[model samples]
Target chain A: MFTSIKRIVRSGFVGFWRNAFVSFSSIFVMTITLLVVGTVMLGNQLLGTTLEQIQNKVDINVYMVTTASQESVLRLKTSLEALPDVREVTYTSREDALAVFRDRHKNDELTIQALEELEENPLGASLAIRAKDTTHYESINAFLKEQQILEDPSAPVIDRVNFNDNKEAIDKLTAIIDTVERVTYIAMLVLVVASILITFNTIRLAIYTTREEISVMRLVGASNTFIRGPFMLQGVMYGLVSGVLTLLILYPVALWLGPATESFFLLNIFNYFVAEFGRLFAVIVGSGVVLGMISSMLAISRYLRV
Target chain B: MIYFDKVSKIYNGGQSTALEDITFQIAPNEFVSIVGHSGAGKTTLLKMLIAEDRPSGGDVFFESLNIHSIPKSRLPQYRRKIGTVFQDFKLLPHKTAYENIAFAMEANGRTDTEIAENVPQALELVDLADKIWNFPSELSGGEKQRVAIARAIVNQPDIIIADEPTGNLDPIATYEVVQILKKINDLGTTVIMTTHNKGVIDALERRVITMDEGRIIRDDAAGKYVL
Candidate 1:
């Protein structure tokens, strides 16, 4: 058994080197496939991070009436926090709101002068509410409306509700992100199918090149396992080599593009690749090996019947 | 012993019959030559012996074991008992003469030590010792056939089937290939050869089976080229 395994390995290596051009072509094509797969994975990750950042910037601010007590605003904050979809609720005192306004306009002379001329702080105390997810924002908004903290004069008597101002922009952004997520999924599916077909054809051509040799081997009293063992090993070698080659190509490109993309996306892609090295290795190499083996198996099955 | 018991083969579901009711027995260590023109079912008959194709009717037997009846898993074991050589020489183009013979041994689960020890002897038996490292393209037609013969006999099979091994060779090369076949036969391996050459059939002068149109026309002991 050991000898048979040894011969299989030796013949597989011999077969690979003997058909150098075909092997190289297979590895090259597989490398490109892995690169595309890796890039899409990175794109998905980037999209997730970008969407999270955008969602984090979305929130509703409820302004209190000038006559409303601070205790009532605190009670409103507690009530907002009790909602299932509401992620967090914070109350900013009028003085604190005024301080923030002053700080924000400190660098602009005209704005600072305008703020100083007002003498009294015009900003109202407010409750800022954040939702757990973009989809939950609507539920939280409904809850706020039902409470009428800002709309109904008798209910909490808040001066204004600022949620509607950014509602349109947030809804558009959510729709775009949802569409992009769906498109990315479809694109991934298409890429997987395309890569499988390409790899299949590539390995088929490689096996076709060895069709004569395979028949000759069959005629020589070689058991099916003995004959197929080498070709399967060759397929595995193609996968293994291409997997490493993809990483070789990917790492340097990721390194070079990391800082460049970081400036645009505010996320370092190289760090992500490195952080997920083990999983990426498994995915790239596993796909290559599986694809190569399947292709070769299909190719060789027709000729082995003799 | 090899026996074809009323074996028949009709290709493509009776679109054509390649062999019909062919019955013959080759004893141990016998040298048999099958003679026929092209498409005489000579190759098909040989294919049946190696279980390459099943006979449509009847059975082929190797030592009382029906060749076609053997399970597919055990077919390799059955085939390893017989070695085959082709007119094309069927030598792997990339393999050297030595590696070609070693490949056969390797297929049969021969160890590295056995392959190393036997491959050189097999090459020497075929008179290709000096060109053991030469690839098929680098060798002459005769030399390539010799390497094929070496590869066939390397594992020391019970029978050697030469299907027009000298078909691609010139007269001198043909003589050389026939002489090597005779040598292998002399060494006690049964040889079943098919050919169209009158000189080869006459020179063989052994048991000759002549075929025409998928039927055996004559079977003669010590026969010549009588068409």
Candidate 2:
């Protein structure tokens, strides 16, 4: 058995190297198809990273009424922090808000002059709210708005404001990313099919080239498996080599694009890409080897009953 | 020993049988010749011996193992026990003549040392030892036929089945090939050969079986070209 295996492996390698052009072309085609798939997967992951960053930064800012006491606003901030969904609540005093406004306009001469002309600080003290999940922000905002401490009975403790202004644009971005993710997955599936077809055809051609040897072997009392062994081994070798080639094409591209792609989005998802490279490599290689073996197995099994 | 017992073979959608109740038996180490016209079931009988094709009716026995009833998977082992030479002289074009003979020994699982010793002896037997490294394309018609005979007998099988062993050879080349098969037969290998040549069959003067339209018209002891 080991001798047969050795013969098959040796024959496979000899066949692979002898048909150098065909071997290179098959590997090249597999790499190109895999590259299209790997790039799209990486792109979609980056898009998810961008969307997640944007969602985390989005929040409902609650401004207290201009006449509300500092104590009332501070007490409301504490209550906001106590809520289950609330991740953070910062109490920005009126003077502290004014100071930020002045500092932001320090480089803008006209805006600084306007802020300096004000006799008293006019900015209202407010609490900034963050939630555990952005989807829960609506309920959290509603609860804060309905609070008796935030609402003034005499003057309404909080002023009117809306947090749903960016709703349409955010929804559109989410929809686009979701659609792209689905399309990318489908595109990947199609590439996989093409890769398998190409590998099958390539190995089929190899079988044709070695048909004389096959016929001779069959007649020489080599069993069916003995005659078909080298071809199957060739298929496996092609798959393994192509799989490694595909990963070779993917890893460096992932590494190079990591920072460049991060520039397009709010965060660098390349780290996630790097972390997942081992897993992705395993899957791609496993599929490549499987595709190779299956194509060989099917092709040889169909034509090589001799 | 190979025995064909009332074996009849008919192709599907055909009106006539290829072989009609052909009964024959040859003892161990016999040199036999089968002569007939084309479509005389000469090749069919040879194939049945190797279980390459089954007798449509009755059984073919190779040393008491019913070849027709043997499972397909065990057929290779049956074939390996018998050497075969075809009219085409099926030497691999890519391999040298020596490699062609060596391949037969390889298939029979002979050791490299045995192959090394036996291949040279087989090639020398056919007087093609000097042309061992030449490919089939580089060799003459007679040389290729010799290489094929060498390959057929290299594994030292119990029997050598030669279907039209000299169908393409000239008179001298045909004599040379028959002499090789005769030598192998003398070495205790049963040689079952089919041919159309009257001169070669008359010279062989061995057990002759004659067939016409699938039926063995005559079987003679120490037979000549009776047909």
Candidate 3:
């Protein structure tokens, strides 16, 4: 058993090296497939990061009337914070709002003179509410509406709710993210399946050329495993080499795209690739080996039947 | 010993008959030559012996075991008992002559030391020891066929089946191949050969089973080249 294994491995290496052109072509095709798969993975990561950044910037701002007390505003903030969907509610006091307005018009002397001539600060205290997920904003907005109704209807303490103004932008962003996620997943699935089939047929063609050699092996009394072992090893080698090649190829690609992606989406793909090198290596190389092996096995089985 | 008992092979549901009710026995260590024209069932009969093609109506026995009925898993072990050579010299084009012979030994689970020792000796026996490293494409027809023979006998099988081994060789190479086969037979290994060459048949003067349309027309001890 040990001897047979050794011979099979030796023969596999010999066959792989001797049939250099065939082996090289197989590896080349497999590397392309692996690159597609790896690129899809990186694209998904970039998309996810971009979407999360956009989501973090989306929130509902609640404005308080100038006459509303700090205690009442704190109570509203505490209630909004108690909601399960609300991640955080940041309170800005009327004094801080007026100070921010002053700082903004600090460059404009006309605006400063108008602000100083005013008897009181016009800026209202506000609370900015953020939800755990973009989708949870609707429920949080509903909760704030309930809070508004609880106030005095004739003379309301709440000045305004800005959720409606931001609603169109949030919904559009959410729809875009959902559509993109679905399309990317479907495209990735289709690409992966297509790559597998192409690799399979390539291996099949390689085996077809060796059909006569396979028959000769059988006639010489080689067992099915003995006959198949070398080809399996060849398949594995193809996968191993192609996987490493894909990874190496991705390094340069990630470097080129890193600055662009980082500037646009605030995610450096090259840094992600390096940080996730272990996982990327496992996925790409593992896929290459598995695809190569399965293709080889299926292709050679047709010729193995005596 | 081998026996073919009333074996008949019909292809494509009786569209053509390759073998019809053939019965024959080959005893141990006997050099037998099968002589016939093309499509005369000589190749089919040899295939039946190797269990490459199964008989439709009868059984072929290697000792007491039915060659055709041997389970698929055990078929390799069964085939290893007999060495097979072909007219095309079916050596892998990518493998060297030494590797070609070593492949057979490797298939039989021979030790590395044994293969390292026996492959050279087999090549030397075929008198192509100098061409051990040559690939099939690099070698001539006779040289490639000799490497095939070396592959056949390297593992020391009980029988060697050479199917038209000299069909492509020149008179000189054919003579050389026949001499080596004769020498292998002299070494007490049963050599069954199928040939259309009358020169080779007459020169052998061994047991000849002449077939016509899948039936043995003549079986003679020390036979001559008579159709």
Candidate 4:
């Protein structure tokens, strides 16, 4: 069996060289298909990173009653900060709120006069809460709603609801980005599937050209695997070439596109993570091996009845 | 020994049966010539011998083993014991006459030393030893036919099936191929051949099994193509 295996491998290689064009073309198809698959994976990562940047802008704000005690509001701010979902919280006292209002109305004398004419400070002390992730904002909202210290019975009504209130617009923006990411993922999946089908068809054609050889081999008493073994190796060679070449073809393109894309989409983000060349290359080579092996196996399986 | 036990074969999707109610037996070392007109189930008989086609009814037995009923996994081993030659030569176009012969030995699990020794001997038997390295395309029709014969005999099986072994040859080439088959048969290998070349068939005057319309029309000692 081992000796037969050697001959089959040798014969397959010899035949491949005899028909150089078809053999090389098989490799070419294998490479191109693997490239398309690997490229989709990288594209998915890019989309994921972009969506994360979009989600980072969301935050939860806690408003305090206008007459709430400064000590109670400070205590509430400290408690909110201790929650796992709360990344950070900034406490704004009533005096600081008034000062901000006065600063804004410095050039507007009528507004400043109206503000002075008011019997009390109208601005409320607020605690701005930053959640660990965008989705945690809702949980933080519920948690804040059950807290009693944020609302003062002696002051104007203050519910734990978000006060800055761009929640609807933020939610809509996140949804749009989420939809875009989903569409991109679905499109990438379709492309990978299409690549496999294309690879299968191409390998099928390669098998077709050698059908006569296969029949003659069978008649000459060659075992089914002995005849099929070489063709499977042919597929492996194609896949290996394709996979390596795809990496070669795409690596430079990725480098060229990465900075250009980063500049366009993530001007203030993406600096936190460094590029991982080895992991990316391993992925490309692995993709080529799998693609080549599977396509060849599929083609040879269809040729089995002979 | 080969026996056809009332075998009949009908293709999967066809109007009529290709072969019907055929029964015959050929003993070991017998050189039997099967003569029939085209579409007369001559090739069909050869197909059943190598287990290429199953009989739709009855059995095809080589000794005690029903040739048609061998398991799929056991087919390669069963075929290794038989040698087959085709009218078209079926030689790998890129292979030398020697490699073509060696390929057969390789298929039957012969060691390299055995193939190296026997391959030359088989080519010499076909009288093509000097042209052993020449590719099939470079050889004449006679030489290619000889290479096909050499490939068929290199493994030295119990039986050599020649389906129209000289179907593509001229009168001279046909005679040469017949001489080779006779020499192999004389060496005690069973020869089963099918042909329409009456001159060679009559010249050899071997045991003839005649068929018409998928049935054995005649079987005679030293028979001729009476059609």
Candidate 5:
């Protein structure tokens, strides 16, 4: 058994080298397929990073009445923090709000004088609320609205929630995220399926050229495994070579696009590629080998029927 | 020993019949030649013996095991007992003459040392020992046929089936191939050959089974070329 396996591998190498042109063409086609897969990986990362940056910039602010106690506000902050949908809630005391207002007006002399004329600070305490997911913001906002009423009805502690003012922008970003994700997933699926088909057909054509040889092997009393082993090994070789070639090709491309992507999308693609090199290798090279094997198996089965 | 019991073959739902109610038997170490014109079912009969084609009726037995009834998984083991040579030579173009011969042994799971020791001897039997390193394309038609014959006998099969093996060879090359087949038969391997060449059939003076259409018309011991 060991001897047979050794011979099979040796024959596989011999066949690969003997049909150098066909093997090269198969590797070339498989490399293009792997490149598509790699591009999808990078595109997904880029999209994910961009969406995360946008999500971070979105938040809802809540204003408290000037008469509201700091303790009550802190208690509300604690409750908000306890909510699963809420990622964080930051509170600015009335004094801190007044200081921020004054700092903003410090650049304009007239605005500074107007702020100082008011002896009591007109600015209210506020809490900035961020949700765990962009889609979770609506539930968080509803939860805040339910807490708008205070136990002391005479003094309304909650003055206003800024959710309505930012609703359009938040909704638009959420929709864009949903649409982009759906479109990207579908596009990636289509590309992967198409790549498999193209690679399968290319390998099929290569096998077709050697169909006569396959029959000869069958007639020579070669078992199905004996006939198929070399082709499968060739498939694996195509995948291994193409996988490495695809990665090598992507290296310079990622480097060239690194600065442009970093400036425009706020993520350096080349850095990400380097950081995820191991994972990328596993996915791309692994897929290449699997694709090659499946294609070869499918292509050679018909001839083995002899 | 081999037996063909009423082996009949019909094709395309009886649109054509390649063989009809044919039967024959031969003991071990016999050199049998099947001769006929094209469409005489000569090739089909060879195919049935090899189990490459199934007869529409009846059965063929190789030493009591029904050749057609052998399961697909065990077919390779059964085929290894017989070496087949074709008119087209059927040598793998990419393989050297040595590799072509070694391939048969390899398929049969022969040890590397055995292959290394025997491949040269098989090539030497065909008188092309020096051309072992040459690919099929690098060799002449007769040389390729000889390489194919070497491959056939390399594993030392119980029987050698040559189907119009020398159909593409010239008179000199044909004589060389006939001589090799005769030599292999002398070494006690039952050789079943099919031919259209009158010279070969008459020259052999061996058991000749003559066929016309799908039925065997004559089975002669020490038969001459009689159509």
Candidate 6:
């Protein structure tokens, strides 16, 4: 058994080099397939992170009336924070809001002069509310509207509750993101199918090139297992080599694009790749090997019947 | 011993019958030559012997066991008992002559030491000791055929089938190949050869089976080229 395995492995190595052109092309095609798969995965990761960042920026602001005291505002903040759907509620004092506005328009002299002309600060103290999920924002807004502080005229603690002025645009953006995610997943599925077909054809052609050799092996009293062992091993080798090649190509591209993409999307793609290196390697290499073996097995089956 | 009991082969779904009602038997260690014209089913008969093709009718028996009746899994083991040399040589282009001979032994699970010990001896038997490392592409027609013969006999099979083994060789090369086949036969290996050369057929002076249109017309002992 040990001898058989040794012969099989040696024959596989020899067969790879013997049919160098076919073997090289098989590896080349497999590498391209792996690259497509890897790129799609990375794109999905980037898209997910980008969508999360956009969702994190979204929040509802509740502006308090001028008469509302800081104690009451803090109480409101604490109550909002206690809600199950709310992630956090931050309190901004009127002075703090004014300071933020001044800092934002620091370069505009007219805005600074106008702010100074006002004898008192005009900005209202507010509670900034964030929801645990982007979909929960509507429920949290409804919960705020149902509060007694906003409805009771006697209390008159709440002034105006602003969720987002361009709610239509936000909804559209969310819809677009969902559509893109769905399309990306579909595209990945299509690519996977295409890769399998291409790899299968490539291996089939390679086996065709060795049709004569296969017949000779069969005529010489070689068993089906003996004849098949080398080809299967060759297939596995193609997958393993192509997987490593894909990673070699992917790592550099990810590294180069990391800083550049971070500046534009505010997400570090390279860090994500590095952090998930073990899983990504398994996925890429495992797919490559399995694909190679399956294609080879299917291709070689036609000739082994004799 | 090999026996063919009323064997017949029809190809293309009975559109053509390559062999019909063929019956023959050869004792162990007997050298036999099968002679026929191009479409006389010589190749078909050889294929049946190796189980490369099943007879459409009747049975081909090798030592009381029907060749076609063997299970698919046991076919390789059965084929290993018989060595075959083809007209085309059929040597693998990428393998050296040494590797080619070793390959036949390797198929039967011979050890490294066994292969190392016997490959050179097999090459020497075929007078190709010096060209052991030469690939098929790098060898001459005669040398390739010799390498092929070496590969066939390396496994020390009970019977050797030479299907027009000297078809591609010149006169001198043909003589050398015939002499090797005769020598192997003398060494207790049954050799069944098919040929068109009148000189080779006349020189053999052994049992000759002649066929015409898939039917054996004559089976003569100490036969000549009397077509």
Better of 4 and 5 by lDDT: 5
lDDT of 6 by residue, B95-206 (tens): 8999888888888889999999999998999898999888899998988999998989988999999999999999999999999999999999999999999999898899
Q: What is the C-alpha lDDT profile of model 6 across A191-214, one tens digit per residue?
A: 777777777787788788888878
The best candidate by TM-score is 5
Candidate 2 per-residue lDDT, tens place, A1-306, comes to: 665666667767888888787777767766667577667766777787788888777777777667778988887788778889989987888888888988888899998888779886778887778788776777786886678454547766677444677555666777898898888889888888887788778777777787777766666677777777777776767667877787787677667766877687855556776688787777667766677778778777656563
Across A1-306, the per-residue lDDT of candidate 5 in tens digits comes to 998899789978987887788788878878987897899889879888987998898898989999988888898899999999999899999999888888777889998888779888888899999999877888888888888754477866778888876778878866886787788778767866776677677767777887877787778788999888988998899999999999999999999999999999899999999999999999999999998898789878878774
Clashing pairs in 2: A65-A157, A152-A156, A152-A157
Off by over 4 Å in 2: A51-171, A266-277, B5-8, B12-17, B20-23, B54-58, B68-73
**DockQ for each candidate?**
0.60, 0.37, 0.61, 0.51, 0.64, 0.57
Return whichever of 2 and 4 wins on DockQ.
4
Clashing pairs in 5: none
- Please give the C-alpha DockQ score of model 4: 0.51
Worst 10 residues of 4 chain A by lDDT: A267-276
Each candidate's interface RMSD, rounded to one decimal? 1.1, 2.0, 1.2, 1.7, 1.2, 1.0
In order, candidate lDDTs are 0.86, 0.80, 0.89, 0.79, 0.89, 0.88
Best candidate, DockQ: 5
Per-candidate total of colliding backbone pairs: 0, 3, 0, 1, 0, 0
- Whole-model alpha-carbon lDDT for candidate 1: 0.86
Report the TM-score of candidate 4, chain A only. 0.75
- Order candidates by TM-score, high to low: 5, 4, 1, 3, 2, 6
* Of 1 and 4, the candidate ranking higher by TM-score: 4
Error of 4 at B176 (Å): 1.9
In candidate 1, list every pair of residues with a backbone clash: none
By DockQ: ranked, best first = 5, 3, 1, 6, 4, 2
lDDT of model 5 at position A125: 90
